[model samples]
Target: MNTSDDDLLDRAFLALADPARRRIIARLSRGPATVNELAEPFAISKQAVSKHIQVLEQAQLVTRSRDAQRRPVHLDPARLEALTAWIDRYRLVREEQFRNLDAVLSEQAASRGRQTKDPS
Candidate 1:
């Protein structure tokens, strides 16, 4: 809810809006990979892959660090957890609303049954 949070979410969603970026995130989910390795599976050039990685980086969804001789891109679970928590909050509210409606319907049905079984 704050502006910063909204901005972060906007960047995260926008970064993931592209198919290539989504695929890159999927690949990173498995494990960390260097730019070259990340680019190998796609038809786009390594530079394009790097650009996608930059977007992901800005979104805080991914981080890159030097490992030995290569820099590997790694998924940031904290950012993902933040996103998941935000989504789950709304999902839980919706689920509770549905449950409340179901209970109301059940009570109405029970009341109708009682009426039907009465003297008349």
Candidate 2:
């Protein structure tokens, strides 16, 4: 990955490191919500929730849009998708490696079986 991609992943992961910020993201995943709405379920103040929202905003994980008197925070699926894609790439690589290992083991077992049967 490029430096910019590394920086973005760093920011995104750091922002999600906090439980409150993670909860905020989870809530936004269900739908958009205002700062007040997000704070309602937390023990923290609305201001604290706003701070969490700011972190998410900086990470490009969430966005805010003006809706009349309210500025609602919405989850940015594109960024989430990017993260997922990065993870899936590594996961797929590991899976392929395991499949190759399994094939090798199976071949080795078959070779041993044939050798024993031939009694050479």
After TM-score superposition, the amount by which residue 19's alpha carbon in candidate 2 deviates from its true location, in angstroms, is: 2.5
lDDT of 1 by residue, 40-62 (tens): 98999999998999889988999
lDDT of 2: 0.88
**lDDT agreement of model 1 with the native:** 0.90
Candidate 2 lDDT tens digits, 1-120: 243888888888889899999888888889999999999999999888888898888889998999899999999989888888999999999999999999999888877756545566
List the pairs of residues colliding in candidate 1: none
Quote each prediction's TM-score.
0.77, 0.77
List where candidate 1 sits over 4 angstroms from the true fold: 1-3, 67-69, 103-120
Against the true structure, whose lDDT is highest?
A: 1
